[model samples]
Target: MTDIKDLPKKSGPSGGWGSMKGIKRIHAESHADPAAFDTLRRQNKPGGFMCSSCAFPKPANYKPFEFCENGAKATLWEQTRDRCTPEFWEHHTVESLKDWTDHELESTGRLTAPMRYDAATDRYVEVTWDEAFQGIAATLNRLPADDVVFYSSGHAGLEASYLYALLARLHGTNNLPQSSNMCHETTSVGLKKVIGSPVGTVIWDDIDATDCYFFFGQNPGTNSPRFLHWLKELKDRGGKIVTFNPVREQGLISFVNPQSPVDMATGRETVISDQYHQVRAGGDVAAILGMCKAVIEVDDEAARTGGELVIDHDFIAEHTTGFDTFIDFARRTHWSDIEHHSGLAEADLRAAAAVYMEHDRVIGVYGMGLTQHAHGALNIAMLVNFLCLRGNIGKTGAGVCPIRGHSNVQGQRTVGIAEKAGLVPMDKLRELFGFEPPQEDGTHIVDAVEGLIDGRIKGFVSLGGNLARAVPDQKRMEAAWARQELTVMISTKLNRSHLFPGRDAYILPCLSRAEIDEQATGNQVITVEDSFSHIHGSTGKRTPASPKLKSELEIVARIGKASLPPNPKVRWDDWIGDYGLVRDLIEATYPDDFRDFNERMFEPGGFWRGVPARDRIWKTESGKAEITTPPQLTSLGYGEKDGRYRLITMRSNDQFNTTIYGYSDRFRGIEGTRDVLLMNQMDMAELNLIKGDKVAMVSDYDDGEDRRLGGLSVIPFDLPRGTVGSYYPECNVLIAISHHDELSKTPASKSVPVRIERDGLAQS
Candidate 1:
């Protein structure tokens, strides 16, 4: 049915005429009208809607075409004319729809009305908003508050997420498992331990002034294409960039800025990274360790020879602790272990260290590559140690920047969508809401899924996300999903999660960020925090896709009103009438971050949520930045052993997280399919397999349960030996739910030890 063999390999720079065509094609396919042009104009501008594509902060300087190809896709996806109304549902049965691909399911279009699953008819029947809300509340009130988990996606704005969290806490539980727990939770936990802040210290201005940017496991070309414009500027300004990833991403190599008419006209490209080191999968820790070792050893040499000091002794002594122990551990780590485990040479690492030594202002940028590991927090901790040796933190253009996915993920966390009660101001919430919030740490995604299977969690309420597909252990999750007593989804479109209805299920239609949210206070503005911690307001310009659609704020408010009993302090009606009241409450809860929220949020480009770490104010217990070493210099899961290859899960250029927009991954030269695996030619030769050979992958774990995928066509590519690459979510079945970061509880989606076998035999 699919042919990947004939797919032409994508070469040259990313973002050229290819991007222009991509933008045009998506909109054309979505049947966008002429007015869509005006809509695109307002994207990422002040008093306009924010791009929900990626969480990269909007640049202070705005351009006419600020949106990227993927942003156009996201916009058009929401503005689509296709509607999955009652007529569409009446024609298709749930069993029949279950066989549809994720792309096919979402492509069916937007859900126009509230729907309730009918077990007898095996279909979804349209229902009124009152019926849906009351039914959900009835079930939620009957169950123990702890038995229900409130799940949120990054789609919801800050006000909606704040209201969602408030509702859950008022309902007497804090089981708010969100999408952040699956992606960048390690960044929060790890960075907080060292710098006392859970997010990056660098702002847009810092990025503009940075001397060097070291990118690890993040591909800006695909996930956040808008970032490439800044990277282009950084390169043109003579800044250096070093990349550490198993696969050579096109985005990291070079870029053709479509905004530059001269470059686009001449077909010229600007190089993005100075050094591209193809580190083996899950080798980030070892690589960081090796870098530290080089910096330390070179500094010792400088001391002996009276050369220039590479390590900042003054900064270290004054602004940090545990440097002595960390340096000792770095010295003890042998080069052999570093080279073998890191899949990088000693000279390469030293060269990278030299680059680091040459620059005073450096930014360590990473993505899920560093996280999504068994020891993800430790991986991040090692990176921090590397940056700390040169006093990178608390500098103008230097810090650890975790490139987060989802537009408002960080914002959601800012408003208290977390499982850990301590992360939020519990006493403040109690005082504001007149209710004692749950004190116990509630379940995260993994624990929530287990709870669903074993009956600890009887109900699930999702703000907006495809939880069924986003999580690991898909097979197990599917079965567990069916066991839920009540399930409520507040979303704009149909998704795979809608198929796995619980005994009592409701799908409530909600408005998109692009659609106007009309409340009693007239048009409303919602806020989101970008990766750089810039909190800004977003105002929708489009009419609601359907008249029945409600804003996320309205849906959350309605649910809160329906579920919780009358409380003197909690006023859901006021929030529904005006979102400014919600901002007032948020300001009260997190005063330091949200002070003067209403006035400042709608300002030109929004205000920066203050980061104390930027001012050399370490929030750590030691009162200074902490330099720490990993428990061991092991691969943390990257080393080759027992003839098993490390499988790194990735997103195609055409895909974003779990949302598949199309079949063409233009940057990777993959077309019409996502079932192909990228393997090294040497590895294939050793196994006596040729290009295009069908293969099967079985996770090499002794857990007794067989985690396997079949019919993956192999494509030869340059990868570290004993390492392979595959698209994620589809291959999520290979990852065990239990295999996750011990501290962050983020699924180890990047590093799975697996054995590749010949197709038919393995399948049989």
Candidate 2:
């Protein structure tokens, strides 16, 4: 973990010897035993556990070694021998541990027992399971339904999420906000509006059949390394890959399949992207519009000369609506405005579009790069609009693929983890559970923060995730969280959020995804839905780290039973004993998708939850795919006035969400620190700064108060001018709470306006 003083070139192409080295490093860090290696072998297998790292879909014929480097890291991390026992809590006070870094906090190891914060002693005391559940229920029962929020991370399996949602609904609250609210809510909101489905339409075979891929604002190398295998295969098969992002990510540039013997022996790497465009932060809309404009202009020429039509007019006329209105907007947009806003030359965009014109089957893949902005939903709609122009939405080899971060984040939402009442069928819920579920929309992360601050929210319950560190405006969020009446965290490991506990805070230990869960019926298996809407069962054989930890499903059921009066229709205790019962209920709720749930659990690759868009069916009011235009061709709302730079936050290779694995981001050539700022050499020169210069960053939000983070090292690197990059969580403080997407309310963590000053600069 030595610090590299100077900014270095990327060590090598993604996923060669570098991946093996990463795996080894985590093995050593986790102190993994040979048994852990045995467990790793079972990952992503038919009868084994699913990888808890990312939500990338598994291939039907997955290789013997199906897992990736990040997956290995996540697996080993959970199997670590370290335990945060009652003795550990006795030695350290919550107030004392507040100064520890996020890595240090989680690294203290897995929680071994349920613990409640004792304010008088400033420490957490171990509590009995009954005590913990009853106490939490008592607090919840006394609070207003809307005042208590039930948050979950993607870690919860399908069974767990379904039961958890039922618990909230039975308790008379729809405040079900989870981790997806921060990363990919825009995908769910935007795609559903356009094509009647929120998830990606493609499966593994679609990637195989496609000849071209348009990757946008996503780095699969660090976030979801398993996707690199597909990119490499696409490249090897003579398919083209074009990338649009603010950073020149190595994952999109090149990759070497570690599983390939020849590649490992020769150290040969397959070049991935045929063309890479480093667009400015928050400029995706303009760049996408430029490409759409090129396609339309080419179609106009074909129409005049009786040439082959580039716009797929026949497909547009039959399957979609608003083509004329959308094309007119693309036609009227000035090229100069596109170039200025996109930070890409017209030639580069036209050339990229030419690649699109050359291929009929294309897959558009994107991540948070397009989602965490003021117009995040519009960004996604515009991307679908571009695909619609070429008849790509419901085609065999073409579609929009929004790569999700969490393994079951989408699954959680599918089974009923949502804030809006309209997102789920309330009539079905009431009929099934024999209870009237709340119809009012619940609070999102942003609204929850404000409610806590203003005393409108009194209780908070989390299934997983480090809330304090994962959200925007950390300084403000922490203060608001401290004021809550009760806070409950159901997690395996300790996180920073535990430190900011409310007056009656409790930490309940839960089983990790890769651990065995034995119940009253027998050993149970859980299910997860991948990014492509494929549902599969995950079975874990590993021993639990602690005997005290309960399954998340059991915990949620116990909480429900302790809190509410017995309802014969909703059998909480029975569902806890046999998870199949929970699946049956899920099938009853989503009969179209989850029919024969238990029977299909043992299937080789499970089944698809059938997105209507895949079959050329639109569930929208118009009953046709809509290709609407955004109000403007630009995505950025905040202007870079007053010499402020657009600050973009990113994740390093060593981390997922707010969970820090190590200090190094090997793919970015950084090590031993997460506080460094990545800047263009030209921008550094103009600011009279060089590599290693310490600076303070002050955010330029319209909010009345100033948000500042100081003591950041400046590192010259590859980025667009007038834009700089830094790691997330630490830089999350610079993002104002109000600065979020208008449609989805996802924090604009990717783009924020800021001014940098030397550490010792005097105030104005």
Candidate 3:
């Protein structure tokens, strides 16, 4: 009929005719009404709902057009009219739905009402909210609190997440693992240890003032396109941009400003990166070591010439400790090792380091690429080390920015959504909530999965996420999920997780950020803190997708009251009636930052929660910034071996975390299917595999079952030799639950050692 959707080419710049075409195509979908789309336009204006896309700071000043392509897609996606009503569930079995792809499942539309699994029918039958809550409460009350894992996602606002965490603690369990456990936990774990603070220390204004911008492992064009405007401005101001990643992402290469009508009309684009180094997957530690080494040599050479030394000696002596040890370690690290591991030549590394040396105000940017690894925490430490060496912290246009993967993910942690104690502190909780929280740390996602597998965990309550699909080792996770006695998903739409039912399961449909939350008090606007620590309130302009749907805050409060009856100390009813009381609690808890939370949020674009690290304030045990030597290079992954390639899992351009917008990944020039593995052209040729050949890949892990991925199309791509790439959730099969950062327990989804063999074909 039509040409196959497999068209692989060098991806062109973003935000031109292609973006317009994409917008037109998306809007043309039968379910997205034009009038509703126009209605959403006004919502993005002043005093309107915040875009639930990326957590990039909303501009302090307003523009007529505020959201980007993906943001619009997210809006339309939530506001889709393709109803998955009770009748739809009546006709389709869960087994039949399982055959459908993630795209088909979500596109089925916003969940209309609560659904409970029927064992005999093998389907989710629509049920009343009271019936669903009663069933959940009965099962939950029957189980031990320690066996319950209360999880949150990026979708929930601060009020919901805070209430989620508080409910868990009140129930006498600290097992509150959210999306951060899967995405940016490493940044939280590492940055707190290094820079004396967990959150990023830079504001949105820093992007414009930065002289040299280093994007370590992020692709902002697809993840956070608004950031491209800042990059374009930086380039226009004669600033240099360098990127170090395993793949030469199109976003990092060039971008056309959608805001600039002239550029879009003329098809003119701005080149983003001046230098890009294709580091081998899992080689971030080595790459950082190499950069550190080059900077050391450059500084020495500058000193020998009787010129200004590149190293900030005064800053190192006064602001940082362990500089001498780091200096010695970097100097001793061999160039051969760096070159071998990073796949970057000595000259390229030197040139990158020279760029850093050339600028006084440099910002280091990184993403999940650096965090979803075995040495993720170490990788974060190295980036901080690099920035601190240049007197980056507590200065204008200079700091480490760990670009997070989801909106409001950082805020969840700020509102005390941690597994460990001392973060929010038991004393603080006691004083704020008038009750004592659990003293010890609880389970991470990995540990929670293991608990389920080993028959330790009995219940799981999800605030808003597809845990079964987002988790590593889907097979194992699904199996573990099946064993739970009770499972609950408080979500806006149906996803893969709802299908993997436990003995008793309930789906509590909740309101999306795009839908108005009308409570007993009044219409409520929830607050979320951005990646840059910008806090703002979002007021949904549209009516509820379904009249039966409850806001996440309401869903959480109901569950809390049902499962654990209101204690005299904590008035659950009060917080549920008025969200302002929730803000009051938050302000009372973290008074220093959230003192004027309500007043400031109602202001233009909210307020910036200041960074302690930016003021030369250290909260470390030693009260000084510390830069220890990075872990050995052997820690990256299984080293090079014949026919053994490193596999890194990534999200397609059209996807957001676990939500599939479409089957096509237009940015990477692929469509229709996601069953392809991107391999280096030379690696494919060496393995005697063609572009469309099917292959079976086995992980290097010694498990007898052989963590294997079968029937995958091999697509030749532009990547470093000995490295291959595949989409996550599919390739998540290869990642062992145990394979994670030791400190953070974040699944090492970015790097895996694997071997591929031709399937039912002879060598060409």
lDDT of each: 0.86, 0.87, 0.82
The digit string of per-residue lDDT tens for model 2 on 316-386 reads: 99999998988888889899999988999999999999999999899999999999998888889889888
Where does candidate 1 stray beyond 4 Å? Answer: 1-10, 635-640, 760-764
lDDT of 2 at 452: 80
Top candidate (lDDT) = 2
TM-score of each: 0.97, 0.98, 0.96
Q: Cα deviation of 511 in candidate 2 (Å)? A: 0.5
All models, RMSD in angstroms: 3.2, 3.0, 3.5
- Report model 1's TM-score to 2 decimal places: 0.97
Q: Write the per-residue lDDT of candidate 1 for residues 1-764, one digit (tens) a residue.
A: 01112222366578988888887887776666456677789988888889988998887688888888888888887788888898887789888998998888888778899999999998999999999899999999999989999999999999999999988988888899899889899888888998899998888778888999999889898888888998888888888898898888888877899888998999888788788888877778889899899999999999999999899999999999999988888888889988987889999998888889999899999999888888888888888888888888888889889998999999999999998988999999878877878899888998998787677888999999989889988888887887899989898788888898999999999988988889888999999999989898999888777899998888988988988889988888899889999999999999999989999987666798889988889989999988886776643544446668889898987777788888878777888899998999988888888888889899886577788888899999878888899998888889888888888889888888888889445321
| Off by more than 4 A, model 3 | 1-9, 39-46, 760-764
Clashes in predicted model 3: 0
